[model samples]
Target: MYSICRRIIFLETVAGVPGMVAAMTRHLHSLRRMRRDYGWIHTLLEEAENERMHLLTALHLKRPGPFFRACVILGQGIFVNFFILSYLISPRFCHRFVGYLEEEAVITYTKCLNQIDRGYLPMWAKMDAPDIARTYWQLKPDAKMRDVILAIRADEAHHRLVNHTLASINPEQKNPYKPGE
Candidate 1:
């Protein structure tokens, strides 16, 4: 169970780092094409990508020991929760060019959230099996990691709500280019 969680965390960290970089790159490209003055937004996007890359590298270097695995899971939970909150509280922070590229930005955000919901979270839940949960409970009695894990789960659920809302608002639209289409 620990090894499974570690592998999932590693994959998720790697996948997420590149995904964030790509999203930021696309957003910047769109902004540049629009001749927008988005210096601050660009800086923020770069910072986000850098942070994700740093975390990914850290996870990559660390062996799948109990402590390292726990930290990776806890950190991922925090990161995902932070991302969801940031999006909900200020979507413009990430989607500043949405006015000029509404369809593309929305499609990208929806696809990203779908990946988290349909892929990452399910894998996370499965990795967190009974024995793993027991080990986690016994090893980390302070419950900080568990709390963060639950919060991440809730954040993922909230993402689903957001996705459903967006889909309802734009029912006719289709993301035909999405993977596994």
Candidate 2:
């Protein structure tokens, strides 16, 4: 009976160590990668470090009863799954709006480019047009929308550059800048 109790104790202690070590190693590796990848973003790095510290503190707390521990683990699993689901759902909605904004930008920029090419106005005159380029920096989105909008804005800027170059080449041409004209 004593031998059986000893074996059970040993197995219980030994079993958790490997799992804890594996989890700690994985978490540390992820933190290191995040730091490396986002070195320029100090705020993000700081937040990640803070979260890591919190997780470590939680891990080192005194052990709970078996039922309580099981409940805690189950709760964590549900929370994590819900968090991931919400994260995914939020981006889907954000991207849909971003697509709308991008499409609007393309149309507005195209119209401005068309007007400039047709000699209806000079390049400087159209600079303040209400296209993506003019208003992109003014708009703010939830975190997910910001990146998507910025990318779309960049593309619009590139298109503007190309169209401006084409327009400059033949200032006297009559509507030579029309799309596929």
Candidate 3:
């Protein structure tokens, strides 16, 4: 469980970078071209915030030391620069990469759920959802960590589909996803 928490903490911290980078890149492009964004920025911003929320939820389970924090800082800095350059060079590739990333996130959370159900992760099996998770996911007051995992898996699935769709579309085309679809 400690290992899993550490992995998730780092993963979530890094996962939160791409969306903000893509959104900002597109925003600047829109301004430079004097064109409308067609709702992509909103969704991208929401994705970034959702990933941040996931990081916050996982943080409730573990308190990282100085080394871990430094690693996250370095990882985030590297990822942010890489993603920004990649988004500028090829938005489609960046979006597809993020789609794959979210697919792995879904898979990871699904595996975690399986472990909890099978009693392989005893601590998580008995744990309650963090308050941040409960609020972010609108889970019931009695929600457990299992419930939190379920919500996270769902969110990841949504992001996976959204990014794949975005990758397939023309950059100037209007985003197909509405606010909450």
- Candidates' RMSD to native: 14.3, 25.3, 0.8
Instruction: List model 1 lDDT by residue over 81-162, tens digit each.
Output: 6655555455445333222233333343344345545664454333332333334224343433333344334433333333
What is the model-wide C-alpha lDDT for candidate 3?
0.92
- Per-model TM values vs. the true structure: 0.32, 0.24, 0.97
Candidate 2 residue runs with Cα over 4 Å from true position: 1-89, 123-154, 157-181
Against the reference, the lDDT scores of all candidates come to 0.41, 0.36, 0.92
Clashes of 3: 0
lDDT of 2 by residue, 78-176 (tens): 644553444244523322333343345456445544544666544323233223323333433332222322433455443333334332443223323
lDDT of 1: 0.41
Candidate 1 residue pairs in backbone clash: none
**lDDT tens digits by residue: candidate 3, 103-130:** 9999899989999999999888789999
Task: Indicate whether candidate 1 or candidate 3 has the larger TM-score.
Answer: 3
**Candidate 3 clashing pairs, residues 3+ apart or interchain:** none
Candidate 2, run of 10 with poorest lDDT: 37-46
Which candidate do you rate higher for lDDT, 2 or 3?
3
**Deviation of model 3 at 34, angstroms:** 1.3
